[model samples]
Target: MSVRIATDGSATTVTASPRTLTVCVVITTEERAEPSWVPQLEDCSPALRRALERVGLQAGELWLHLLGIGLERGAPTAAELVDAVAELAPAELRRHLVGVHVPAWRALVGADTLEAAARGDRNADAVLLADECYYGGRARDSLSLLLPLSVAQTKKRVADVLRRFHNEVFAAREDELVAQLERDVDAKRARSLSPDALITAATRGYVYEPEPELGRVVLVPHLAARPWILLCQHRTTRLICYAAEPESAPHAQEVRARALKLGRALGDEKRVLVLARLAAGEAGLAELAESAGLAKSTVHHHLVLLRDAGLVGMRGNDQGYRYFLRAEGATESSGVLGDLLAPR
Candidate 1:
């Protein structure tokens, strides 16, 4: 409920100065419903699906790893759509699987926009180029949020989706889409949004909330975890947010639990090695200890913690106890870790 992110000299008071815009969160009336005035988000859904499908399974795991149950429960298609991309791919093609990631390559709203806006200089271009996956904005955290996919691959997929949309969907749906967008714009103009409302709505799972200084803030509702903050890192700064719904209050405990588990499991180098080993297959405690070059007791202790965190599950056999990672748990834990690391 409290403001977790703050910028120096940010407007503490919700005074009407300038900088506010609202576009439809967007949704198609339905696949076959009569065209209505609703600003359709049909494109956003497919765009995400296509992007993930283009990227493949690595994309699926990555999205889940970063977003946890949020992506699994909310934007299910995103990860599920690409579940087989890597498996069905040729070795060379599969090798091209870079990776999916949290945050994103760059903030839709770059640091440039944040600084400029703070100076009372809003950039129009920054608000124009909002990315479809809008829940990412911390420009400084780019390196840590790295994906496995190459630049070329991402670009190619984006281009291909756009091309397909241009030829098929957009051609048939442009009028509807644009009409709804324009209508939403007009409707938003009739209402005013306070700064507090803007910040609260803009933020998602992470602690860091971005308070960009802009005269014209455009909120594009999305179904992703974070609101994509496209800053003006390049051209003109566009303060646009492809916002996903905030996590329900009930789910907060789960997020915190996952984060804590990942934290405890990741704190030691030996445990990390244990996790890496388990990634390949199950290993007995002796093997894990030898490989990690830690004492048996030490390794056992690590395993205990990992097991409790649900990072690893162990079984007893004729030889002794063997441990293997709970892949889903690991992913969910890691995803929470990403959320924890997001820029404040």
Candidate 2:
């Protein structure tokens, strides 16, 4: 499932000078990958997975937001980042984890109310529920899970899960992962792209038009977030966790695997109809579902497959998610398959 975090910014043009922009990368597990993208992350630890599910934390990109916050605070290394979270006061840790879902949560909810909610004040909880930030289905669940617990209790559970995940899932390949991300960051830096272009490239085609209140945009490359970008806004700063670019050439097996993925995406009649509708222009989930003559849930399933195959991309707006075809992926499938089957 995709983890879509809402933002207050509308679709508008925003420009930033080099002094206001920062680019970096953070460490996370392949478990962060969307279901559509990887289907299965074989190395993901079963125990760690169980821990996440137990806490009702299905969206792995939530950790990416935590990592991005740490990166912004000068916790460059994974170990340092884990420490950063560990060091935060229990109340502050609760805010960071919950606020990652809701934009401008502090200003909107106020510190006192948040504290009250942590203390099991129903009125304070209602205030948070009424706020627009907590409106998303997942955001609602995130808040619900933590609201019942004391802030300190939430902190203990969150810290335990993060530390265990880092040690069991990310620590072994830390060097290799960091080196790959560094190469991508360096390559992007060398290009000297304009702010808009850099954002689009970093997000793999998401053209972010920062809001007027925003000043700094930090792009954090994440390997687990492939084919999907995670966005978090902290007042004036926007943290974009983008899919990391692979440093190595695709192996023969890799090429074939991609071809098979594309084939699966194109295999169904309803999905083909959905693609045809998207080919004409961008459409929201409802519109595509209508065009495909299927339930929104069924249409969403097809969209996920299309997304995983790299044939579709989406942009969020005030209205909701609007999806479009990735022309490059659609047009290159034949060549990908040909390369896979060509005589060696």
TM-score for each candidate, following the candidate numbering = 0.28, 0.73
- For 100-178, candidate 2 gives per-residue lDDT tens digits of 3334555556767766765567788778766754433345545666566777877877777767767776667777766
Q: After superposition, how far is residue 337 of candidate 2 from its true place, in Å?
A: 4.2
For residue 62, what is the lDDT in candidate 2?
A: 43
Model 2, C-alpha of 240: deviation from truth (Å):
2.0
The sequence of per-residue lDDT tens digits that candidate 1 reaches over residues 247-343 is: 3345556666557656777888889899999898998877998999987868877876676556776543112456777756757676787776667
Model 1: lowest-lDDT 10 consecutive positions: 15-24
Q: Each candidate: what lDDT?
A: 0.40, 0.62
Of candidate 2, the 10-residue stretch with the lowest lDDT total is 16-25
In model 2, the clashing pairs are none
Model 2: lDDT to the true structure: 0.62
Query: How big is the RMSD of model 2?
Result: 6.9
